[model samples]
Target: MTSPHDAWLAEAVDAARECAHDESPASLEGAATRLRIHASLERRRGSSKRRLTVISAIVASMFGSTAFAYFTGWRPFAPATEPARPTAAPAIEHEAPPRARTGPGPSVPVEPPPLAPAAPPGEPAPPVLAAPPAAAPPRATVGPPARRPRVLPEPAVRAAAPLSPATTPAPGPDAELAAYQQAHDAHFKGGDPAAALAAWDRYLAQYPSGELAPEARYDRALVLVKLARWSEARAALAPFASAPVGAYRQREAARILAAIRDR
Candidate 1:
């Protein structure tokens, strides 16, 4: 009986021997070529793996750098943040109380002055008198009854001739002449123009053909002007335009009429 361990070792050695014996030159050569190809493939696989590892490391580094930059607030093109503004302090509040003044104030009392004294009653104040000058001498007078005149004998005188009828005083005042004179006095001498005009009208009616007719008409026109009756004034002046130049108021009427026409 063989021991168990020796038997297993022997079997492993037999298998090794058998495998060597079955190998041939051609097979070895084929095996060497296959091994070389396998080795080249394995080298390629190693190179590929190394390259993948390098790429993975680069990608991981990029991701880590980006994450770190995001968390750290590092940005190449981003705008900078403004500093925070300081907050204003709250305002303090206060309450005001009414004030009370001390001590008494001054007083103002106004009083008027007394009136002047009154004069004494009755007993009229003595007249303020000027001093008298010396008295004048008395004038002398003579009595008129001392001298007498010699008397002459009286002679009877023939009666005075009877007064002629022509020489007798005129019977009455000339009515027409008196009226014209009154009108003239009222219109020219007196300042009352309305009364003057009324008197002139009466004179004209009583003595239309009197010598003073033209003069009366002219004065009437003047009064009419004062009365502001321009039309009637012009009518009064119309007759004088054809009157003789020597007429009393012809020239005056013409002048007044021309003035009226111009107006």
Candidate 2:
């Protein structure tokens, strides 16, 4: 048989061995579970940090873009100013003057009589009575329609008056004789036979009873003879030849007559 101390030591030793086996498995399982938990927590923390960094960068980029846009005059949220509208100037209108009242100064507007109600169909309408012609305006003093004033002739325009002195004497015999002598000079001195004939004829017609009348006949007969007018020369010289025997041109007229008859 063994002692009691030896038996107690064996029991204690068995108990200690059993406790070590159970504690080692439990500690190992607890440590492995703690490592798995710690790994999951670390993965979650890393994802959260990356997401926060990305979010912060995106926010910073958006703020920078907005500030750049504001500085460069490219603002996205600034209110715009509308252009000013031009105001129109008021118009000045001038009113015209009222016209003069013609046609008898707006006579009392006579209201027409009201019409009767319509008669049955097919009945002839009654004729409207005409107004009297308003007394013909008092005949207007009519007065011969205003005779156009007569245009009397002016005193200066009537028969013209003589322009010379009333008392001027008539031309004398000597003056008349001088005119005849001047005409006679035109015949011989001017050497124009037709002009000489015209001069002699004028003297004879104007002064048939003058002292130069016979001389005018004598010279006119001579001019007719020079022009080959034999019949006129004969007729002209006949009167002078038959004149009184002592007449101024009687002998010359007879000589001219004889010369014409010879031709």
Candidate 3:
């Protein structure tokens, strides 16, 4: 049995025994406990690092989101802007006051010249007389005592006899007739109807029953017709119409009256 393989196995067994004899159980247990403690400490340190990274990521995400929202017009925490203050106006230049106007100065007083002395009284004045003229011769004067005899007025010539009632002249039919004819001619032939009518009316008022009265009335009616006085024309014709022997113009009056009534 003292072969080479056998010797090597024995040497290995002897070294193991020597190593087992040198190490203590207490030391081995102590080393194992230290290794467990180191492993646990390393695991705790790794976990703490991972938790810190996760927290940092969450904080960065929130900050990015807030910045994005702020750029998109969200201003939840923005302070209010103040109104701008107005600029003050510049001061204006002032003009000096105008001088007061002064009129002319006071005038100096002047004294008047002295008056002359008064004259003394009591000097006597000279007297004056007028001369008389020579006389002329007297002539014979015709005085009232040398008067001539006078004849008396012939018994105060008795006032011409007072006109008696019988002597008083009366308006005659001939005068009325002449006046009516004159008025008629004036109205018809002379072209003076107003004067003619006046004269006719006077004649009618003075001698209503004269021979020419019918002619006067007829002419007056014609004058009225010419004047466009229908009513007065009708009135003027009335007297002629009632007469038994109507005047020459009565027939004409009747014809005109008929024409007016028809109208």
Q: Identify the runs in model 3 with alpha carbons over 4 angstroms from their true place.
A: 1-160, 164-168, 239-250
All-Cα superposition RMSD per candidate:
35.9, 25.7, 32.2
lDDT of 2 by residue, 1-263 (tens): 86544554565566556656767877657655655665676678779989999999999999999899888978458678998998988988988986544344334456666677787889987876766454433222323356789998877747676768867666679877976887789778988888888888777777788877767777788888988999999998898788899786788888878877967
Q: Work out the TM-score per prediction.
A: 0.32, 0.34, 0.34
Model 1, residue 214: distance off in Å is: 2.2
Error of 1 at 215 (Å): 1.9
C-alpha lDDT of candidate 1 relative to the true structure: 0.76
Q: Which stretches in model 1 have alpha-carbon errors above 4 Å?
A: 1-173, 244-248
**What is the lDDT of every predicted structure here?**
0.76, 0.75, 0.69
Candidate 3, residue 178: how far the Cα is off, in Å: 3.1
Q: How do the residues 1-263 of candidate 1 rate in per-residue lDDT, one tens digit apiece? A: 98544655575566556558768777556656655665676678779989999999999999999999999998789778998999999988776775444334333343444443554786466545454554444433433456668778789898999999879554234877788889889988999989999999998887688777777878898999888788988898888866899776778788888888855
